[model samples]
Target: MLSDDELLRYSRQILLKQVDIEGQLKLKGSRVLIVGLGGLGSPVALYLAAAGVGELHLADFDSVDLTNLQRQVLHDSTSVGAQKVDSAIARLSALNPLARLVPHRTAMDVDSLDAAVAAVDLVLDCTDNFSVREAVNAACVAAKKPLVSGAAIRLEGQLSVFDSRVETSPCYHCLYGHGSEAELTCSEAGVLGPVVGMLGSLQALEALKLLAGFGEPLIGRLLLVDALSSRFRELRVKRDPGCAVCGNHNG
Candidate 1:
């Protein structure tokens, strides 16, 4: 049951015909895991929390750096030496005290990652590391959970939703098989703040659609953003039958 305050707090979104009372309840009942509390994770966390997600499991092992303020809006000058997850908690808590915040301040290895994925209803992969992304995807595949993945570097950004629960949907592994060893990070290649912010915001929208059961998710499609030209393109994606991570699950 939504408290009177919850009803008032989320009235705007709840008013949407697609959402209404049922969808607001769904959002309040959903538990989400957000991996990475950096550039991409910032907006994802903010929107979801403000939207009234019941519980948010935040995972990040890095401490705040002064440089992160440019894109990581979840933190501030006072958080420079604090852990990212801690800073996120402070900001998100203030944004919506009705939302519960769970922090995973340490790096999650295979076993821990598996447990985390299993505990949540959905996951948002906001990490910038390919290896971490692959690991998170494998865990989601094994747990049969939905994953909303986003990435941004330089002036380009991409967003996708991979759900092993959907037969035709591709897992992250199916789309980026054994990613390049030379892949660059934002720190190395340099990314505009709004580029990551855009992808992260989209990632949040995708998660809400999935959690609230309201609209189409990017389950079998990849959205590409070209900030320089201010254009958007989407490519159809299919699950790889031989995908090492999710193949057996589908079979």
Candidate 2:
């Protein structure tokens, strides 16, 4: 049951017919795991916290760097030397104290990652590293949790949702198997701050929809954003029967 303060604090969102008191309660009950606290993770964490998600498990092994100020909005100049998860906790707490912040400060191995995924109701892949994304997706598949994945680099962005619980849904490995060895990072390739911000915001929106049980999620679909041209396109993705991560689970 929401206290008077919660009802008032979340009044605006509750006003929406799509998200009345019931949906707000759903948001309050959900637990989410966010991997990475970089550019993409920044806005994802911000919006989800602001929207009043009950628990956010923030996982980031890196510290805030001066370069991150360009797009990682959660950290400020004061946070330059701080751990990303610590910085995120500070910022998110200020944004919404009602939202619980769980910090995973150290790097997570396969076992730890699997345990984290199993603990959360949903998972968001906001990491830039393809290898990390692959690991996260595998963990989600093994845990049978929904994964919201987003990436941005060099003015381009991609967003998708993979839910192993749904037979028709494709896991991240099904979409990008053994991602390119030449994949570049934002530091190496350079990206517009807004590009990653936009993708992260959309990822938060997708998460809200999924957690609150309203609207269609991007399952089995990939959204491509070309910031250079200010154009958006989407492609239909099919589940791969031979996908090593989720193939055996899908009929």
Candidate 3:
């Protein structure tokens, strides 16, 4: 049942034909794990919280840095020395006291990553580092969980959903070969402030749709947004029959 505040807050979404009372309930009953509290993860957390996702698990070992002011909006200037998870919790709590937040201040190692993945209904790969992205992907694949991955740099961003339950959906490793191409980290190559927000917002939309079972997700397609040209493109992405993690491990 929605409280007066919830009804007022999400009235727009609640009134939607696709996201009616039942869909809202599904969103409220869902659990999501957002790995990384940086640029992309910021908006993803805010929108999901406002939309009333039941629970959220946030993991990040880094503290709030001044340099992140432009993009990591979740952490304000006042939270400079605070832990990323701490700032995120405070922001989300104030945004919606109804949300249950779990914070992890340490990085996820192989031993503990699976447990994190297992606890959530889905995992959002917002981490900028390719290595960590791969690790998160592996964990989701192993747990047979859906992974909504998004990335942005300069003026371009990419969004995709890798649902192991969907036989035709492509895994992250399938698009960017398992170990090919030089890894790109957002730290070294800076990301435009709004670019991350744009991508992250789309990620939140995709996640909500996935939870509510509403619209067609980016399962077998990659959507790329170019803020520079104000254009967007979608390319057909296919699952590799030989994908080591996703293909071999039948979810």
Candidate 4:
């Protein structure tokens, strides 16, 4: 049951036809795991907390750097050199003390990753490189948790949701196989602040939809965003029958 203050705080969200009191309650009961505290993780963490997610587990082994200020909205100048999770927790707690915030300041290994995924209702992949993304996907597949993945570099951004609990749904491994590729970083390629912010916001939206069971998630569909051209395109994707992570070929 929501306290009167919570009811008043989230009144706007509750008023939405797609998210009435019932949906709001569902959100209050959902636990979310957010991986990364960089550009994409910033907005994802902020919005999920503001929306009253019951608990949020933030994982980021990095620390705040001066370079992160431009796109990493969650950290401010004072946070320079501070642990990313510390900075995120301070900001998110200020936003909604009612929402629990757990910080994992260390890098996530396979054991820790699996443990985190198994405990959450949903996992948000705000990671940058393919390696972490692939590992996160495998963990979610084994745990059968829904994963909302987002990425941004330069003026481009993309969002996708992979729910392993659904038999026909695609996992990240289905989209990007276990292959090596040039890893791009915002520092080298240069990402517009708003570009990553846009995807991060949408990532939060998709997570909320999945948790509240209110709308169609991005599952099996990739939403491509070109901030420079102001264009949005979506490509339909499907599960790979031979996907090692979520296919029968696991053997």
Candidate 5:
């Protein structure tokens, strides 16, 4: 149950018919793990923390650098040189002290990722590297967890939900063909700051809907955002029949 303070703090969100007090309670009881603290992770952290997600676990190994200020709104100039998780935690706490914002300030590896995800209900994949995305997806599939995966580069962004708990939902590997890290990257390419924010917010929305059991999630659909044209498009994406993670052929 929400305390009187919480009831007051989240009054606007709770007032939504789809997110009444009961739904608020569900959010309060949920644990969400975010696997990055960069551009893509910025708005996800802010919105989820503002919405009163009970426990938010932030995992990131990078420290605040000057270049990060352009998109990583969680940290300011003063936070440069500090741990990214530290900057994220401080800002998120200030936003909603009621929510427990736990920070894993080290780089996530297979073993650490497994342990971090064990108790969480949802995972938000905001990491920029393809390898990290694949690793996070594999772990989520192995643990049968739901993942809201998002990416942004240049002027394009994408959002999708992979619920291993659902037989038809596709994993990250399904949408992004498992391969070497030679395709897309923020390093070689440039990304608009707001593009990342837009997708991150969508990721938070997907996570909230999943936790509250309110709306149909993106599941097998890939929502694309083109900031250059301000166009929002969603493509039908189905689980691959031969997908090794959650397909029958590989199983």
Candidate 6:
């Protein structure tokens, strides 16, 4: 049951045919884990909170630097030197006081990551590096939770959904082998501010669809954005039968 305030806050969302009162309530009852609080995390956090997700667990260890202000919209000049999760939560809480925001200021260890993933209904992988992304995906696959992963570098962006809860759905490890990939940082690669923002916003949209059971969530498909040319493309992705993380072979 929605409080009068909730009804009024989410009335526009509820009015959508695909997201009637029932869908809005589902969103209000769901919990999500956002595993980064940088450029991608900024919009993912804001939109999810605005959409009335019941609880949001934010995990990030970095402190805000002036450089982050370019794309990390959740923080302001005052947040410089503050922990990313703390800065993000402060802004998110103000955006929607009705939503519960949990901040994890430390980098998640293996057990901590697994526990967090198991505890949440869904996860958004907003981290930049492949190591953290791999860890997050492993935990999500182990817990059989849905994971929405997004990345933006330079003027390019990519988005994908890997739902282990579905039998045929590919886990993140299926798309990219467990082996490490060359790490790319926004600092080195130089990302356009809005590129990450666009990817993050798309992540939020996918999360809402997964939670509210409306529209097709991007499962087993990758959406690529070429911000340089303002073009978008889709690539079909498949589960690897021998994927170490989600495959039949088990040690």
> Which candidate number would show the highest lDDT if scored against the true structure?
1
User: Each candidate's TM vs. the true structure?
Assistant: 0.99, 0.99, 0.96, 0.97, 0.96, 0.97
Misplaced by over 4 Å in model 5 are: 248-251
lDDT of each: 0.95, 0.94, 0.90, 0.92, 0.89, 0.92
| TM-score-better candidate, 2 vs 3 | 2
lDDT of candidate 4 at residue 23, scale 0 to 100? 92
What tens digits encode model 4's per-residue C-alpha lDDT throughout 93-211?
89999999888889889999999999899999998878999999999998889999999999999899999878779999898787576876888889989999999999999999999
Clashes of each: 0, 0, 0, 0, 1, 0
TM-score result, candidate 6: 0.97
Q: Which portions of model 2 show Cα errors greater than 4 Å?
A: none
Q: Which residues of candidate 1, in runs, are more than 4 Å off?
A: none
Question: Over 4 Å off in model 4, which ranges?
Answer: 179-181, 249-251
| Candidate 2 structure quality by residue, lDDT tens digits, 1-251 | 99998999899999999899999999999999999999989999999999889999999999999999999999999999999999999999999999988999998999999999999999999998888889999999988999999999998999999998899999988889898968888889899999999999999999999999999999989999999999999999999999998999877
Q: Per-residue alpha-carbon lDDT of model 5 for 1-251, expressed as tens digits?
A: 77899999999999899999989999999999999988978899999989989999999999999988898888999999999999998898889888898889888779989888887999999998888888899889888999999989999988999988887788888888877767777767878888898899889999999998899999889998889999999899988888876675234
Which lDDT tens digits does candidate 3 get at residues 1-251?
Answer: 87788778888999999999888889889999999989999999999999999999998999999999899999999999999999999999999999999987898898788999999999999887788888888888888899999999878899999988888877898888766347566677777899999899999999999998899989999998989999999999999888887878753
Candidate order by decreasing lDDT: 1, 2, 4, 6, 3, 5
Task: For candidate 1, write residues 1-251 as lDDT tens digits.
Answer: 99999999999999899999999999999999999999899999999999999999999999999989999999999999999999999999999999999999999999999999999999999999999999999999999999999999999999999998898988999999999868999899999999999999999999999999978999999999999999999999999999999989998
